[model samples]
Target: MYVPKNFQEPDRDTLFQFVRDNSFALLVTTGDDGIPVATHLPIELLPGPDGKFQLVGHLAKANPQWKLLGRDTPALAVFSGAHSYISSSWYDHVNVPTWNYLSVHVTGRTNLLTADETLAFLRQQVDKYEVHSKHPVSVESMTEDYVRKEMRGIVAFTMEIDSMQGAAKLSQNRDDKNYQNIIAELRQKDDTDANEIATEMAARRVDNGQ
Candidate 1:
């Protein structure tokens, strides 16, 4: 989250879009003994009337991590997007190797939702992910009794994110010659991460009038 000025992404909408595209994130918190715990889960972002973002997600009932969701415990959600290694060989000038990546960190207080709210939360998640399905399923498709029984096994919570920071280090600090060279080399790789970072770098060039 310590983003240098040139790498800091200040656009709120762009940051939120990154979260939506990469919905799965690392939810971290500290326990009573001060041991840090992290849980990986998919999340939904809800914009509040007060212009705050609420991160919504559910954890299995058996997961003790959910106990950290209280006003006393601070929650940090981290969403990581494309990342790739930058080989010094790709740069036109002599330079050390580095990595480029995009990520966002959100810190806020969290609270568990009521049972009714949890059910609604699950339905909303289904709607969001079922778009690609030819036969989309709905919570209404299942009996209320069965849904209630299944809901007992999970804990839903929402974090009203008070702070959010985004970093997009896609060779923006490099000169165009070296930047374009890195992107060209990266695009030659078959790896997804490499290709994605390359695409972002190319877009940055267009934004810079290169």
Candidate 2:
């Protein structure tokens, strides 16, 4: 996450919102062999000590990646938001093509939770994602015995984020006219991802006081 001053997003609220909106993230760690491993999981971000952040997610007990966390190993959780291809045609002929995106990298020490802690973590995730739904579900509705049994199938852990870096490269370096053209072109596309990126670009313009 080598974010230039212009592209860096240091706002805490902005980074948290990005994580919430794009909750599916890549959890990366180094295996026992010292090889990097990545697992794609839907994560729930929670407040940590000293106004920091923590990431909670579960992986199958069968997933060997979880074994790397017992000793407070370092890990990274990467949350990627909307991104799309930007055509050079949207800019002047001299301009080259590029991709526009928003991403946050959370680096932290990983800790595997105990069985009881893991159950609570899973409950929190269900509450977070389901509370706003039209038909909200509750862990209480499920038999306590059954819930305990189910928790055995997965390993839950929390990453207490030691540092976080966010980058939002949304065509800010482009001239106003070129940026507007890029937004317009993106809006014309049927892909929702392109349209979402365009909206973010427009919002970034306002945030930068451009």
Candidate 3:
């Protein structure tokens, strides 16, 4: 992530919130052939007391990507938030089309979790995603035997995040007038993704006291 000073997201809380809001992430690791393999999975982001980040997720045991973890291999988890294409028309003809989005890249050491630990991880993920649902589901409701059997089909792992890099490119470099125009154009669109980017840009402006 090549984040310029203006676009750099240095707030730890903000980055964590972004990860939680966009839990579905791309997990990448180098395979034995030295090729990069990626898996899309829903992950749980846990923040440590020391300001480090931890990620937990599971992939199908049959997926060869799981074999890349452990040892000296490094993993990257990429979380992406609302993104949309910005038209040049929104920029007073001075700008070219570009993407407005938010993303966080987490690099860390990967470790496979023990069976017992994996079970706990699955339970926590269930609770996190379902806690706010209108019809919440509990892992405990399932029989212990069934849960164990289900866990066997997947490989659970944890990443002790060594570093996090965040980039929020929302026309921050544009003049206030141009930025306002872009926001107005985005907000008028029917697409939810465009609206989301507009909202983030608005919130970021407010945060910067602009």
Candidate 4:
């Protein structure tokens, strides 16, 4: 979350889109013992009562991390996008190897959701993920009693977003020649992350009208 000025992404729309694209995020909170606990889950971005954005997700009730919620302290949600290793050899000038990536961090106060609210969230979640399936299943397809029984095993909560920050470290600091070379090198790799980074870098260049 320590974003350099040059790498900082201040656009709210861009950050929100990133969160939606990379909905599976890391949720972090500090317990009463002052130790940090984390959970990896699919978090949805929604507007809260205050008309500001918030994060919604559920955790297994047995997970101790859920106990850390609804506290005075805030929780952090980290949405990570594509990343790749950038070798120094890709640059003409002497430079250390680094990573090129995109990520967004959101922090906020969280509160437990009512059972009805949680049910609604679950239904929406199911629909969103099943949209691409050939025979998409939905919570509505299941009996209400069955769904309610399953909900008993988990805790749902919403974090009203207080702040959001993003970092886009796509070799923007490098010279034009080095930047182009890095993208080319990344694209040559068969790795998914590498190809994604290359595409993001190329897209950013076009966005900046470079």
Counted clashes in each candidate structure = 0, 0, 0, 0
TM-score of each: 0.95, 0.92, 0.93, 0.97
Clashing pairs in 3: none
**Higher-ranked by TM-score: 2 or 4:** 4
Residues 31-121 of candidate 4 have per-residue lDDT tens digits of 8888888989999998777887889999999998998899889999999999999999998988799998999999999999999999999
All predictions: root-mean-square deviation over Cα? 1.4, 1.8, 1.8, 0.9
Number of the predicted model whose TM-score against the real structure is largest:
4
Alpha-carbon shift of residue 62 in model 2 (angstroms): 0.6
Q: What overall lDDT, based on C-alpha atoms, would model 1 receive against the true structure?
A: 0.89
A best-first ranking of the candidates according to their TM-score comes to 4, 1, 3, 2
Q: Which portions of model 4 show Cα errors greater than 4 Å?
A: none
Estimate, for each residue in 80-190, the C-alpha lDDT of model 1 and write its tens digit: 999999999987667899999999999889989999988888888988898789999878878667888999899999998788899999888888888888988999999
Candidate 4 worst ten-residue window by lDDT? 45-54
lDDT to native, each model = 0.89, 0.86, 0.87, 0.93
Q: Which stretches of candidate 3 lie over 4 Å from their true place?
A: 47-52
State the lDDT of candidate 2 residue by residue for 68-103, as single tens digits: 875667899999998899999888767789988889
